[model samples]
Target: MTRLVSYDEAPPEVRRVFDDIKRTRGVPDVNNFWKALAIHPPTLERVWQNLKQVMAPGALDPLTKEMIYIAVSAAQGCEYCIASHTAAARAKGMTDAMYGELLAVIGMAAETNRLAQALRVPVDAAFRAAPPPPIPKA
Candidate 1:
């Protein structure tokens, strides 16, 4: 059985935000992460607000944003973040093919990034000064 903790044990402000979070986010109960973070309700609220604001629908569609999130989480090796964002990506309309390509690109980029770091590759002056290549006429 899960250990039950009384909200009275939590800080008064934490309890207020926890109640608000449950109501606003429509979760029947507080998630483990939030329960732990309830130790710092103000910080939790700030982080949640910032995340929600940035992730809301905008110039980038939700699925595309989710894909970006997944790629970053994968690069950082945050398994929890990867799982959450991948599920969000799928919910926002990612397909198997798209997910495959996304993973491939992320993997390739990660490999190249590691190689560059390992080799201590410096940006060449020639490449930095190079003009844009001419576009082929379609």
Candidate 2:
């Protein structure tokens, strides 16, 4: 792994994003993920900005969003994200019971997803949605 950037050694661009992250999350320092991304300041800033917007409370409550993030992270097998989002969820008032239930749901979903894939299950008409918009050319 690349060296994690320290705040004292960071350049202006990294420092700006780091400062924002620290302020927004009310943390003494940004986590190792941000530290790693610090090597690429543009990506660090972009991800930080996007995370702030997406994780902010809106239609769904903060705890709900955090749990959803945890579920997706678990499914992707991203250990770091799962751990990080779990902590965030706890802070957002996720009790032990909620965590247990979330884990059960994640496990069941994973099992069913794999089984469906292996069986080549067709999508039910009622469960199908309209196609998404075309991706924009980069």
Candidate 3:
């Protein structure tokens, strides 16, 4: 069903990408996305490298990054990305409770964002600054 070159039938360059993917993920299986991308070796390599750099540990933890990916994917209505990120999140130790809470928060935020946009809500001045601490008792 794939319109692109299959993994086993790929050229050396594409095969190299597949090998790297296997080693990086520590899994023998390559997903359909990568396999489809093999038709264009440069694109496949570029995408893989970018993914590696972006997903690597930084200011944000891997799990948090995955959750963010899921949220954005959901908002964008990208079912493939959502499912992919959800699985990655689970593999990164996301619990069922955390997943449920994540979805709830995403839904609430989306609804409120739409409501705010519809009403043309202005930014509240109070929300722009952190609250000052209480004065110490004498």
Candidate 4:
């Protein structure tokens, strides 16, 4: 059981946040994570706004962003975040094949990262920003 405020019993400020959450997510239920954060309304609002900005469409599509969130959550061993982001990714049209591929890539990247860290490999100059492409002859 959470020590934080419950959505139904939350104060006006918290309820306003909850209402915004419902409207934005189009879901009537508030997740326990949000309810737990309600203990500090300011933090709750700040996090919600930040999430909105970060998750909104931009260079990357929402599905890709959710997949990245899932990857990071898995790497950090945050089961709650992994579960939530996996569901979000699936809702955004991720398939079993894509999930399998994503996990494979994540595993490979993790292994390579660990190896590089253990060996203290220096990043190659070639990997740095390509020397400004030779200026085209006017």
lDDT per residue for candidate 4 within 1-138, as digits (tens), equals 666677768999999999999999899877878988998899999999999899999879999999999999989999999899999999999999999999998899999999999999998888775677676565
The TM-score measured for candidate 4 stands at: 0.89
* Candidate closest to the true structure, highest lDDT: 2
Structure candidate 2, residue pairs in collision: none
Measured against the true structure, the TM-scores of the candidates, in listed sequence, are 0.71, 0.90, 0.85, 0.89
In Å, residue 33's CA in model 1 sits off its true spot by: 3.4
Candidate 1 lDDT score at position 104: 95
The better candidate by lDDT, 2 or 3, is 2
Worst 10 residues of 1 by lDDT: 1-10
| lDDT of every model, 2 decimals | 0.80, 0.93, 0.92, 0.91
Q: Tell me model 2's lDDT, rounded to 2 decimals.
A: 0.93
In the range 1-138, model 2's lDDT, one tens digit per residue, is 788999999999999999999999899999999999999998998999899899887879999999999999998999999999999999989999999999999999999999999999999876687677698776
Residue 106's lDDT in candidate 3? 97
lDDT at position 98, candidate 2: 100
User: Which model is ahead, 1 or 2, in terms of lDDT?
Assistant: 2
Per-residue CA lDDT of model 1 for 1-138, tens digit only, reads 234334668777777777876786576776665666665668767776777788878878889999999999998898878997898689878999999999999999999999999999998999999999898776
Clash list (residue pairs), candidate 3: none
Clashes of 3: 0
Candidate 2, residue 25: CA error in Å?
0.9
Provide the global lDDT of candidate 1 against the true structure.
Answer: 0.80
- TM-score-better candidate, 1 vs 4: 4
TM-score-better candidate, 3 vs 4: 4
